[model samples]
Target: MPQARLLPAYLVQRYHGWKATTYQDNKSWYRRLAASGQHPRAMVISCCDSRVHVTSIFGADEGEFFIHRNVANLVPPYTPDGQTHGTSAAVEYAVTSLGVAHIVVLGHSNCGGVKGCLDMCSGEAPELLETSSFVGRWMDILRPGYERVKDVDAAFRARALEKQSVLVSIDNLMTFPFVAKAVEEESLTLHGLWTDVGEGGLEQFDPVRGEFLPV
Candidate 1:
């Protein structure tokens, strides 16, 4: 078997520096965490976009948040087929094994995945229509969301779909039986949040108001 290639030198140097500083600053915390185990109270489902920093936004510490990131931060409807379901597997681990009390679907402004879905639904991005387009199939999870926001003016469709993605993921989360049971027993709670990347503003979804409001 062949060994994996090494990372770039710059990244390796940066990682070493960070490791040194982290050990100097919080050696005991790291040691304790290693001896004990993770007991995160929340699971954050977020986008794969590099701009969205989940821990920085929430000021979370190590072992505090169990995060699962995918394109558009989507949670597909529960399917028990014997296929690889990465997001579903993460949700199962968070809910059943970790017993996370809260699940937060974090969406964001100017999401490329949402834009891709918008483009695909609008018949603008023809390449994504191919059966081999993994991203296209993943973005299909947000197709229903695109339908709900498609009628909006082109200028605002991307933002609208972004928020809709959060709502859609929340709805899908409930489709999982364990998640539904946890909610019914008051053992688990769900939240929807969207962030404006440029303005650095946060908005939370209100089921009662059926809108995202500033947080």
Candidate 2:
């Protein structure tokens, strides 16, 4: 639940006094619109990184991007074969119930989650990994991607890992029945995005071009 929207404003008024203007100015706006309901056009699956905010990065309004975040933003393959999947359920709601026409999988440069996985896969010194942590489980999703590019030149390893994960996520997402149906009907388009914070540039995934290019 959203504590910001639920807490009695006055209870924390002093602590949040700095944001008083935005809070008071938009006091009723959020409730009014949230009560009406959400009709976001796209659902974005992203990493829960402090620097990679879905709305700020995409310049989206309140409900423009139905965002679902996880440690590394991996999309597990759909299995009606009874596996519990929160991300899968969110995507189902977006595509089947809410009728979102697009879904974007966002990957970013120098992601710690991806780095952790790569380090683990390398059989590096024990000091390189911190297993038995939730972050370890989250990074495990990149195993397939890591295996795919393990033999690439050392110079391109970082870029390769990021790109590989984005492609893996796209492939896994398509395993969903609804996603397959949408693609068959051409009603939904799946996109992959890679963010470069240093240059502040966004790259779009292009399967045919086999590279991330300027959008």
Candidate 3:
């Protein structure tokens, strides 16, 4: 048998230590969780930024949230083209299979993906202009947001786009028939969140006011 190319030695050691301590303190909890399947109450679609920790922000425990991470936390409109859609797949599973009550699209400040979109739209990053650029294509989901905020000052456009991305995703989530049906029946609720990493501030979207309020 061939050995797998594992993570760095220090990270592996840290994982071992964490595994031992977690199991030692929560052995029964882990055992019970293994016996019973996970029943998370919410599904969180969050940015794939290292600084953003969804679980830490909400003080969520294991099996509490079904999390899906993607660039800029953007959700493209639901298209049933039979092509691969990782984010859509996760959303479908969370709604249909897990029956989660809440779905949150979490966007954060200083998202590299958002910045990339900004750069691409502004013609600063020509490399992203290529049709073969995955980041460019994926970030295209946020292009509509950029158009809305294009007139804003360059310094603030990025931040504006970050919040816009959340709004865009929330709209896209509704494009899915199952999601719309669930929402219409009051079986599922959608939420949008924007976080400031440096200032440790959290803002929640208010559908009534059409704005994000501090949390």
Candidate 4:
């Protein structure tokens, strides 16, 4: 909870240079954002992978989308155990508090967590399931998914796992009472998307086709 005191002042210089062109034109926006409240259109749950950026891909400006990032964007079934999760809290607030109309789960190609779960590739068992180390447990949630495509060609298998992980996250996203209620009441729509990191291809979930289709 400490202030971002570690932020290098020089890094502000990078933004400073751009501020003249963009920051100057949007000075009112900065003022209003500071004074006004957040009114985002959607909530995006994405991976912690550095290569996969939600804001950049969607060209979302600050406050346009409420976002939550985790090692694999895993949404646990609503647990009343008093352990509040940032992702779950974001969903609760965005839906119940802010009334966002859509919730998007974004996953990408060549995810290390998916790969670990797909192949159970971790070297140590304790390390796999540890509270802080999530790949093992999160991967377990997708074990059925892994088995669902394990026998396919290696290239196809990888693609399937990455794609299936989005579905897994979507299903889990629904387990939260707020999310389910919102969806049931038609207040919110859920979307699962796969981004091909290499070429930035956008694929949307096609339930009828039982796969992702180019969009």
Q: Write the per-residue lDDT of candidate 1 for residues 89-109, one digit (tens) a residue.
A: 999999999999999999999
Clashing pairs in 4: none
- Per-residue CA lDDT of model 4 for 38-70, tens digit only, reads 989898888899999899998889889989888
Candidate with more favorable, higher TM-score: 3 or 4: 3
Per-residue alpha-carbon lDDT of candidate 2 for residues 1-215, written as tens digits (9 for 90 to 100): 45466557776876587457765778687787679899888999988878887798767767678899886778877767676778889999999999988999998888877877787788763444466566666667788999988999878887789877788889998999889899789999999998886778899988898888998
Q: Which runs of model 3 end up more than 4 angstroms from their true locations?
A: 1-4
Candidate 4: deviation at residue 6, Å? 4.7
The TM-score measured for candidate 3 stands at 0.96
> What global local distance difference test value does model 1 have?
0.95
Compute the lDDT of residue 18 as modeled in candidate 1: 84
lDDT of each: 0.95, 0.82, 0.95, 0.81
- Assess candidate 4 and give its lDDT: 0.81
Off by over 4 Å in 1: 1-3
RMSD of 1: 1.1
Report how far residue 12 has shifted in candidate 4, in Å.
Answer: 4.1
lDDT score at residue 214, model 1, on the 0-100 scale:
98
- Order of the predicted models by TM-score, top scorer first: 1, 3, 4, 2
What is the Å distance of residue 79 in model 2 from its true position?
2.5
Indicate whether candidate 1 or candidate 4 has the larger lDDT: 1
* Model 2 whole-model lDDT (C-alpha atoms): 0.82
